[model samples]
Target chain A: MDELLRPLVPQVLGVLVRRGADLATAEDAVQDALVEAVRRWPDGFPEDPKGWLVTVAWRKLVDAHRSEASRRTREVRVLHDVAQGPVEQRDDTLQLLFWCCHPALTSASAVALTLRAVGGLTTRQIAEAYLVPEATMAQRISRAKRTVSEHGVGADGDLGAVLRVLYLVFNEGYTGEVDLAAEAIRLTRLLARLSPEPEVGGLLALMLLHHARRPARRDADGMLVPLGRQDRSLWGTSLIAEGVDVLQTALAQDRLGEYQAQAAIAALHCDARSADETDWPQVLEWYDELLRINPSPVVALNRAVAVGEVDGARAGLAALASVPDDVPRRAAVAAWLHERAGEPATAAELYAHAASSAANLAERHHLLREAARLAPDAPGT
Target chain B: MAKFLLLKHYRGGPQQRPNARTPMEEWTPAEIAAHLRFMEDMADDLRRRGEWVGGEALAPEGAFVRYDGEGRPPVTDGPFAETKDLIAGWMMIDVESLERAHETAAYLSSAPGPGGRPLEEWIEVRPFLEYTPPVVD
Candidate 1:
């Protein structure tokens, strides 16, 4: 099914772009057409599946226009142009991508909308991905659609906004039910074809490298295991090699975006034979480049860890203190850095607090384990 | 047609628990308005289908039946307790089928509030059953 739908994306998107429609609407119409074809085409497949989808979706939009009184006249005016166009020549997906990730929408909403329309995800899938209820996701998408209709002027302006939206989606840690990491990679690969930016390639490489080790990141019961504790035998060497290969090519492009820098960090980590051999200095340098570009406190907090590994635990503790209190993972990082700096009592106290404050059970357990290891005589034991 | 009572449990007078902290507000003003709009739309849809009995949004959490101790008759109160987890309001509806009731629930939950967030709190839907018993031999 994936193979069959793969080739139809460009053709379906081409027609949608030409229809002068929003990506959300175009995607809805296309999905409606796809459902119809799935129901009817069991005897034999159509030779030109893309052509059929374009025709069906075009008709569906007309029907939709006729049903809604406000859009009737506007749609009627465009009917002639839609009829005259050859669907194959148009690049609908690319246009839809830009429209869905329009700068007017918030970054979160843009990623949500793009995942729905371009990534072919249902509201349930998106809601699961974000740990929101399905109803909430549905409402979010509906409000976004209304906003686009009432406020947005259409997708004639910026593509960088769209690229940033995709990258953000990639960075969000997996939760709920959907694997956003995989979905983001797929969208980046698709977007790379439309606009082959080095950052796009870099984002893809970064995702691939991280995802390659996903197997070893957690235990059978879903507890997080740090890189030093992870079983290296479980890592997918092929994915690591592929990610390295992609990052190398992207680095050669000389664009040097934040994503490329992040990918470079991942590549260096993947290159090390063991945890001790991992180049903390190189990772710290790349993180500095990332900070120069993005200037995020989260990035600063991460860089502090590298600095600690390279410079010493006391320096890392000071760096961690410089980060804001509310930033995610602040306490855990602080606890670990404090532990390394010969302050076991302070480390255990912070670790216990961090464990209690953890959002998920796995993280709580991991934090508690570190706390217990640091203080054998602690009461919780 | 079947009728549904979206029952909100409002205890009359102030809450007895002194240590209860102030309830965290669920939705802001914008969220409440959006939810009202959704309820209005749902009622309108039901009315159009000839299945809507009549629904009313109650006054804030203060209005409810007050129970008297020692088997005395219950009285009503205007401004209610300081309970944080109080039900703000409810809606009663008359529908033709269980499916329609579910549809109404779905539509009501789809209303948007702050930052495009949905006002998705739990809503209970129960059937109004009518049973006919057989005569004894």
Candidate 2:
């Protein structure tokens, strides 16, 4: 029952908002409707759960408005008329997503609000996922809602904010009880269904392609397994196939965005039978396209790594010259390229430096091991 | 955000800075109270900022126990008279960045010491290993 009702949350909230309810009020009404559904659905499931939720939530909104004397100025009659009309089965989730990811809200606030309103996650769950206090997350959600109401719903044409928030959630990696990567993928899949935008498809494919490698990303003791060393058999073939199909379809649309280009690069990696067999030239071309679209230092750093794989280690080091020194993985990439170039001592020192500054424990451990392996007096040596 | 354990050592860590190694017992009572107060206030501030997960100061004395092989009872050893390294306390925090964790550790390291001066103790900032699988990307 919960699974059936989860996807309807955004739709119900969207209907209420379209019927003149404020964003906060609509969300509240939808939450109330959800609670009511939970209490009543055990006996039987409704044939039209989405419609039932929309109607019930709309009534709840009207009732709340009628009871609030201060808000009596709002035309309850117009709201009722709008609610009584034929229920348009239009996808309101996309509009609700746009509202939740409104530019007025900070990225953190946007992520929290989207998780709550669109992803059907509780405030406490979201807080736990973020490792912050429940009250802090609650305040953040309310503040985001207030900001969205003040700014009005953002234009639906741009899904950049929504995609960025989803990407952030995906990158948050697993920590708390919530599987945020899976949640992001789920939300992206839903967004792809609602919006035919090539970028939406691109984002979905990117997540799928990344997620396909989850099984081989960690070793038995929970240590990071770099892409080159991961067990190829553990990769999810079905997800890879689906991702490749999605990326191909999005590419056919002729609208190349950063996400599409990134997915294309990911698809190329996924298609490789082994690290040695990976088509670095094609991968580098995709990175070139990505850099052209979004000239971020992180992308530049990644491009340098790809360049190293395609060209000689010297060419890769030359590529690194274009990237800023302060990028998080700059030293680590340099270490890798230096090692490839037969400069083990320099590689070891850089690896040690990178390990000290690594934010993630697993990554830090991996870098330290790399340093140890490269050191002159290492045990095996 | 990431969770980090800022460990304050009783006896082990980087070499103490020159002119900064005064023992706690030798400090004035007022200075000791001020140091304790600073530690408490730091915890309070972290809680207020919603960054603190937990904190604890361990007793100076502790015993080491090991299980006996087979069906035998466990063997217990006395708290050693001296040890090279002893953990004093730890504060766990969930923060936005590694830099923020370092900043918090630095702040905690500034607890008042002998003559009401900053201790400047080295606080080891270690990230908690997340049990969850990493995202492949």
Candidate 3:
């Protein structure tokens, strides 16, 4: 079998699925075919691997039908459907993408399972990557699969949902052993290939733009360094270039969505040679669009930062005031706004509180850095 | 070196508030055995790496005692109602520092167990605050 076929297994599974053959059975049969290839292909290579696997999996299903009575009932008339030569390649992979990211699964499980089953990552590798025990990850994947299967969430038009899942996974700063950021990009590329949707392309661009600066997100002590303080020399220029190119194309399409709005925001950040040079007005405009679509408190909080940059700190604080007080990152955003407004005393107090109450290590470190920068003579130190 | 208590909490510690339970099907015996072996191997590997410390797993049932007026120790029934939140077991270790202690604990928590899942058992870790030795006058 061609080695490339391995990467395209998710695409193959997408193609095999019909209206009657349930997704679970299709996935199992695909795995069986892959296993058979692994066993037999040790000697040499095949001319057409995708066709080979499809043919083999179809046969395996027949053999399976003889013994498994329950599965036989669900099995539809799939004969010439197994032929894989010169087939009209519909964007079937997009359906698999959406199915894996169905809303029924938790955000974490959706990303993990998509990477595993769709991305063809081994369970152990996935577990190790995520800093989870293999058993725990296995159970998570299984549970996610069962949820999708039992809920009968068909592999239909769920591109938007999958895009959200990918974005959520990317935003979870890497605390676990996993290189979640890189994994997110890889999944995004696959999604982009299948769907070619503006939002999917936009997400890939946004992730790339953010990731290009990951080298500057931290310092020697593993403490988080904010975008303003980061050394621009360390940023991945090549990634930024690629991201800009993709985002420009997506923008040309003019099909605005949350990911596209986010990409536009990222594009503004990437365009700035220095943090002070950022186009805050443009970013604020994008955030307005994002808020209109997503309507999230977190988005509103982020929007305030851009407002502060564009319309002065007082204006930003007023914008933030409209947000519900119970928002998770409200204090952190308020602290930054206060600092921008030249109220160091209030900023320091808010930073101290936010640092102590931060949900994750990276954010806590970021808050502490901000606090320390403002109040070096504080008594606690 | 550092010491860790597999420290079952007595009280006043955070517990995971219940959330929706994900339904799972029963695993086959082979799956169960694979999970158990993974855990045993993990513990052995930790010990081989010189990370394992003295450990114990207490029975679910336990006894409690109270002293009153320093006259005599009052014996209480096993599992007194007041002792409902007592320590279940403890592990003691002398690690180089807190980071190493965390690494070891994370390892233990990741070990596979019954139900083909990593154990969800919660263990509290506390560092012993040094106390002044008694002086002889």
Candidate 4:
């Protein structure tokens, strides 16, 4: 039932917005319609759920305007704007995405609006996922809608910002009761359908590739498992195949964006039969291309790790030196390099330091385990 | 998101700030009331932001207890740690980033002490380890 309504949330909201209802009011109207549907739809699913929602939401918007606009004689035209929306249901979903990710809004505001309008999530759900107050999230979404409405423009929303917001949603993974990563993938898939840009396909492919590896990311006991140590058979073959197909199609377009480059790297890893069988040289080439595409410190650090895999530990360490020390996981990478360089004591010490500074419990525990493993191997033990 | 524990110490920090020079007992009752009100207000503000998880003030005294055998408990007296022996209290907050955690901790540190002055105390911020599986490793 939820899957049925998810796509319609944005379409209905878009309809209301197109009818000259303010974006924020349109969102609230959609929300009210959703609540009414929750109450009424259990008896029987609406024949046209989108149409039902659009009518309900549009009525709500009209009622709201009547109560507020009774003071203004000119606002009496609200009735005339009543859309024959159910019959004229041209998909306005892509425009809604553009509206939510409008350049006038901040990234945080855009993210909140995108989640509520496109992802069909409640304000409370997004708040819980983001660890913010429900009121704060509500304010952010409303403010974002108003910002976009006031700065109303054509379909010129920065797709890059939309991609970033989607990536952030994916990175948040499952939080509270929301499977944000799955939602992000779903929304990206919709975007890919709407847009002809290869990067959109590339983003969808990248998400699929990473999501496919999620099953192997942790052991039965919920312990963090490094990619090399993960059981290869656990990887989702269908998702991998889908991701590879998407990546190949995107790459064929010949405009290499950051996401396509990243997907290519992920494909390289997925193609390998085993850890030892990985094509490190080819992986290194993608990293270099990624560096050219997006030269971030994190990327540099990741590239250094690849350098270590392709070359020797000493060469890896040299490459790592160029990466800023403040980057997260720098110590962990150094520890790995030192361990492979036959310096157990240095590795163990670095691992311990890395564990102390680790951002999350799993990574801290993993780093501590690495440290403990090397502690006995070192001369002191 | 990260959860951080901001530690307020009874007898800690490398050096005491100027506002903390006078003990709470020596301050006037009005000053003490004002300080407590500041704390309540701060906690209330955090609760409004949905960041405040919990906080509690501790009694001054404690003892180290250990298991002797299977059932017997042996307690040690007059042997407190040379450092961080007395924690006054702590506030737990869940925030978006390390920077937010630090900002919250700084706000807690600015709670009024004796003479209605900001303590500017050193509040220790420790992150709670998250148990969620990584999306990207």
In lDDT terms, which candidate is top? 2
* lDDT (Cα) of model 4: 0.83
Clash pairs, model 2 backbone: none
lDDT of 2 at A267: 89
* Candidate of highest DockQ: 4
Report the C-alpha lDDT of model 2 over A1-381, residue by residue, as the tens digit. 656777778877776776667889888788788888889988888888888888888888888888875466557776778898766666788888888888877677788899999988878888888877786667678777888888886465348988999998898777867889989998999988878889989999999999999999988987788999989899999999999999889999998999999999888888899999999999999999999999999999999999999998999999999888889879999999999999999999999999888766788888999999999999987
Among these predictions, the greatest TM-score belongs to 4
Fraction of true contacts reproduced, model 2?
0.24
Indicate the worst ten consecutive residues by lDDT in candidate 3 chain A. A74-83
DockQ, all candidates in order: 0.03, 0.21, 0.03, 0.31
Q: How does model 3 fare in lDDT?
A: 0.69
List candidate 2 stretches off by more than 4 Å.
A59-86, A154-157, B1-134
Compare candidates 1 and 2 on DockQ and give the better one: 2
* True lDDT of residue A332, candidate 1: 85
- For residues B3-98, could you state the per-residue lDDT of candidate 1 as single tens digits? 565533233323423211222254567756765676677666554443444455555545568778878988886553575445545655545456
**Collision pairs in model 1:** A13-A92, A14-A92, B23-B84, B62-B80
lDDT of 3 by residue, A281-304 (tens): 888988889999999998999998
